[model samples]
Target chain A: MTLDLDFHSTLYLIGLIAVFVFALTGALAAAKRELDILAFVFVGIVTGIGGGTIRDLLLRTDQIFWIADPNYLTVCIVASVMTYFFAHWVIKIDRILLWMDAAGIALFAVLGTSKALSYEVAPLIAILMGVISSTLGSAIRDLMIQVKLVIFEPEIYVTACLLGSLSYVVLSHFGINEVYNILLSSGAAFLLRVLAIELDLRFPS
Target chain B: MTLDLDFHSTLYLIGLIAVFVFALTGALAAAKRELDILAFVFVGIVTGIGGGTIRDLLLRTDQIFWIADPNYLTVCIVASVMTYFFAHWVIKIDRILLWMDAAGIALFAVLGTSKALSYEVAPLIAILMGVISSTLGSAIRDLMIQVKLVIFEPEIYVTACLLGSLSYVVLSHFGINEVYNILLSSGAAFLLRVLAIELDLRFPS
Candidate 1:
C-alpha cells in the first residue's frame, strides 16, 4: 500500500533513515571490536550525528539539528543498545544491510546538498557539503574502531556521493522540481554504489 | 623580553599559539607516515582547528572562529609547511615539544571551559567541553594517521585537561577574575602534565 506524505516530511524521513542506518553500522563496528556497551553507544551516536554536525558548523546553522531535537540522539542510543544485544542477527543480514546503507547515504547526500544550496552557499561548497555529510560520520566511526577509512581505499564510494550531490546542484539550477531533483540524483547514486559493490569497482591503480 | 599586552590580546595569542603547536604535531605525524604535502596540509588543518571547532560547535558560537577570521587557518597551514621541512629538527627537540604541547592544551582547555561557562551551560558540560577542546584535535590527528589514541592509553593525558577545566569552572563559580582563573587552572594542568611525563604517570591498570 502506498503511504501519502508531503515533500518536507519525505525529506525528513529520508534523513532520519540515514541517521538510523549509520548508527546501526556504528554499533556493528563496535560489536566487531568486542567493545563495551558504553563504546557501542558512543560510536553509534558519533556515526549517526557527526556528519550533520560538521555540516551545520560549516554552514553556521541557527541551531544544530540533533541538539535542537533530542530524538535523534535517543534513536542512536536505542539503536546501539539493540545492536549490542542482536549483533549476530544484524551480521547475518550483511548484504541487505549494505544495500540499505547505500540507499540511505545516497538520500543523505541529496539532503545535505539541498540544505547548503538553500543557505546560498557556492554550488561547489554545496556539493562538498553533500559528500562530507554522507561520508564523514562513517569515517569517524571506522577511525574510532581502528579500521581503515573507506575514503582511503580504492573504492568508488566518494565518487558516487560526489556525483549525486553534483546532480542535485545541476538539476536544481535547471529549475527542476526539488522532489525530482532528489529522486533522480539519489537514485543514480544508489545504483552506482550498488554496481560498485557487486562488481568491486575501484579507481584504476 | 616580555611585551605588554592586554588581557583579551593575551588570550588571543595563547589560542593562536595552541593552534600552531597542534598543527606542528599534525605535520610531524604526516611526515612520519611519509605522506605527500597535500595530506600533510589537510591533516594539519584538521588537527589545528579541530578542538576549537568542536568547542564552538557544542556551544553554537555566533561564528566559527576560523571561518570568521582566516588568520587561524593561515597559521595552521603555515605551521604545517614549516614542520614538513623542519620535522627532523622539531623531532630532535621532542622533550621540549611535549612540554609546549602540554601547556598549549592546558591553556586551550581553560579557554573552552571559560567559553562554555559564559554561555551558561551546566558546569559539568563546561568541564567536558574544556577537555574536548584540548584533546579532540590531537585525537583526530592520531585517528587520521592510524596511531593509537592517547585517551585509550594508560597515561594521565585527558585527566590533566579535565582537571584544568574543572579548576576554571570552580574558580569562576567562586567569583574569581577570569584572567586569574585562566592562569591558575592552566598552570596547574601544565605542571601536572609535566610531572606525568617525567614520572611516567599512568592510570592504574
Candidate 2:
C-alpha cells in the first residue's frame, strides 16, 4: 500500500508539471496583437491551476495546491516565460503537442481518481472528479479564446477520460495492483483518443 | 420566514433565467462559425449552466443545476434560438444589456451565498462561492475563447460580489430578515459595480 501511494504521488507531480506546460501552450495560442505579459501569466496560471483548484475546493481541502507548494506556481511562471520566448517555434509543433495533451489527459484522470478515492469519496464522484480535472483546463482555455470547447465536440475526448476513470475504479475495486491498473487505464484512454483522431470517429447526434 | 423563503426561491429562478440569457449570448456569438445547430445548443447550454454547475459541485450537491431542473435545459435552447434570431438588433442596445448583466451578478451572488450558508459551509467559503457563481459564466466564456479573464484584472468586479456576500452574512448574523438582507447585499453589489464602471475605479495591482 505504501508503494502504491508513493507511485501515485510521483505520477501526480509529473502530471502537475504537464498541466503547467499545457497552460503555457494555451496562453501562447491565445496571445494575439501584442499580448500583455501579465495577461499571458494570468492565462497560464488559470489554465494550469483551474482543474486542481476546483478539485480541492470541492473536496473541502484547506491546502490549495499552489498555496501549499509554491513550486507549482514557480513552474507556471517558468513555463509561461519559456512559452513567451519560444512561441513561434512551438506553434509549428501544434499537431505533435496534441498527442502530449492526450497523454496529459490520461495522466490527470488517473491521478485525480486516485486522489479523490484517497479522500474517501464514492467511486462515482471520484471518477467524475477525475474527468473534470483532466478536461477542465482545456475547457477553460477554449472559453477564454471564445471558441467552442473541443471536449463538447462529438469526439472521444471526455468520454475517454470517463472510461479511464471507470477502469481505475473497477480495477481498484477488484484489488488489482495499482501500477497495473494505472497503466491499463491510461493506455486505454490514450489509445481511444488516438483512434478517435485517426479514424475520425465521432459521437452521433 | 416562509415568505422570505419564497422570495429567495423567486430570485433563484430569475437568476436562472439570466443564466439562460447568458448561454444564448454564447450561442449567438458562435452563430457565424458554420457550427451545426447542436453545437450552438451545446455552447448555449454550457454558458448558461457552467457557473451554477461549479457552485453546486463546490457545495457538494448531488449532481448539478440543470440535472435537478430540466426546465433549465429548455430555457437554454429557447434562449439560444431567441438570441440567434434577434442578436443583430440586440447588439444595438448593448449598453442597456450591460445593466442587465449587473443585475445577474447581483442576484447570482445573493443566491450563491444563501445556498452556501444553507449547506453550512464556512462564511468565507460562502462568500467565495458567491463570487464564483456571479463571475464563473463569463470566466468560462472567456477561458474557452482564450481571452484574458476580467476577474484577474485591476477591476472591481469580483470585489463587488465579495462585499455583497460579506454584507449578507453580517446582516443575517444580526437577525436581519432574509428578504431585507438579500436586498441590501444585492443592492450594494449592483451599485458598486455600476459606480466602478462609471468612475473607472479599479483594484490597485
Candidate 3:
C-alpha cells in the first residue's frame, strides 16, 4: 500500500503532468487563432514536446523522448482533443491556464536540467537547456499563433525558469536528495511565477 | 585534377549554399521586424539552421550539423551582421531575397531527403522531413517576425519543396547518378518556386 516515488518514477510523473499542461496551453493558444481541430492537435503536440525535443537534440540522445515512448504523444493528443471539445469552457479560465503553465514550466525546467546533467554537460549549459526546455515550447506556440512571446513580455517567465534551474543545479551539487531538489526548485519557480502574475512584477526592460 | 563532386561532398556543398541563402533570408525577415542587430543574428541563426536541426533530431544524428562544424554558425552570423549593416539597401531587393530563399529551399529539401534516406527512414517519412526542412525555417522566421506564414500565402513554397524532395527520392530509386539526381530535383523545385513567384500562383486555401 506504499507509493513508489523513486527518482526515475518521480521524473516520469513530473514529465507526464508537464506535458499535459503544456498541451492544454498549446490548444488554448491555437484556439485563439481560430484554427481547426487538426491545428489544435498539431500545436498541442508541438508545444507539449517541443522543449524536450530540443533538449534531446542538443544532448545527442539516441532517440527523442516521445519517439522512445509513445505515451507522451498520446497524452499531448488527448489533452489537445479534450481542450478542443471544451474550448468555450477552457477559454474562460485564463487564470487557470496561467497557473497550469507555471507548474508545467517548473517541472520541465527541473527535468531538462536533470537530463542535461546526466549527460555530463557543463553546468551553465545544463541550466541554459533547462530554461530553454521550460520556456521555448510556449514561445514557439505563441509564435505559431501570432501572439507576442511571453518571454518578451515585461512579466517574468524565463527568469523564473532560470532561477528554478539554477537552484536545482546548486542543490544537486550539494548532493541534495532528488525529491527535495525537485520540490524546492519547482516550488521556487511556481511561487515566483504566481507572484509575477498577481503583483504585476517584471524585470526591467 | 578533376573537381571532386562525390555524393558526400556534393551534399555538403549544397548544404553550405542553402545555409548561406537561408541566413540571408533570415536577415531579410528580421529587417522587416525592425529588430536590432543582435536580434537579426539570432533570427538568422534560427532560420539558417532550424530546418537541419529538426532533420538531425528526427534522424537521431550524433551531432547537429552546425554544432559539428562551426562554419554554418559563422556563415549565419556573418550574413546577419552584414545584412544588419546594409538593411536599407537589402530591403529594396525583394526579388533577390525571394530567389535566394527559393534556392535555399530547393537545396535544403534535397539535402534533408538525402540524409533521411541515408538513415534508412521510410520513404514517405524522408520526403516529409525533406519538405519540413525546406519550409519550416521560413515558417519559424515569419512567426518570429509576426508575418503571415509563406505556406499560407498563395505562393507555392511547400509544394515546391515537396516536389523537389519527391523527385530526388524517385530519381535515386531509379539508380540515377547522384549529381544528376540532385541537379534535376533541385532545379525542378527552384523552377517551380520561380514560376510561382512570377505568376503569383497560389494553392486554394
- Candidate 1 lDDT over residue span A39-150, tens digit each: 6766898899888888888898877777566667777878889898899998998888788889878987888999999999999999999998999999988878788887
lDDT of 2 by residue, A1-205 (tens): 7987888687767776677766776678557534677767777777777777777766666688779988778777777777777888777877777677777788778878888888777776677678778877777766666566776677778878877889999999999987899889988888888788778888663
lDDT per model, in order?
A: 0.85, 0.76, 0.84
Please give the RMSD to the true structure for each candidate, in Å. Answer: 6.9, 8.3, 6.7
Separately for all candidates shown, the number of backbone clashes (residues 3 or more apart, or on different chains) is 0, 17, 1
Residue A152, model 1, lDDT: 76
Ranking by lDDT: 1, 3, 2
Q: How many Å off is the CA of B78 in candidate 3?
A: 19
Off by over 4 Å in 1: A1-5, A199-203, B1-53, B62-131, B134-138, B144-146, B153-205
DockQ of each: 0.13, 0.11, 0.14
Who is ahead in TM-score, 1 or 2? 1
Residue A78 deviation, candidate 1, in Å?
2.9
Lowest summed lDDT over 10 consecutive residues: which window, candidate 2 chain B? B29-38
Candidate 3 Cα errors over 4 Å, as ranges: A1-7, A36-42, A81-85, A198-205, B1-53, B62-131, B140-146, B152-205
lDDT (Cα, tens digit) per residue for candidate 1, span B47-98: 9999889888778888878999888999999988888888889889889878
DockQ sort, best first = 3, 1, 2
Q: In model 1, what lDDT does residue B18 have?
A: 83
- Error of model 3, residue B37, in angstroms: 18
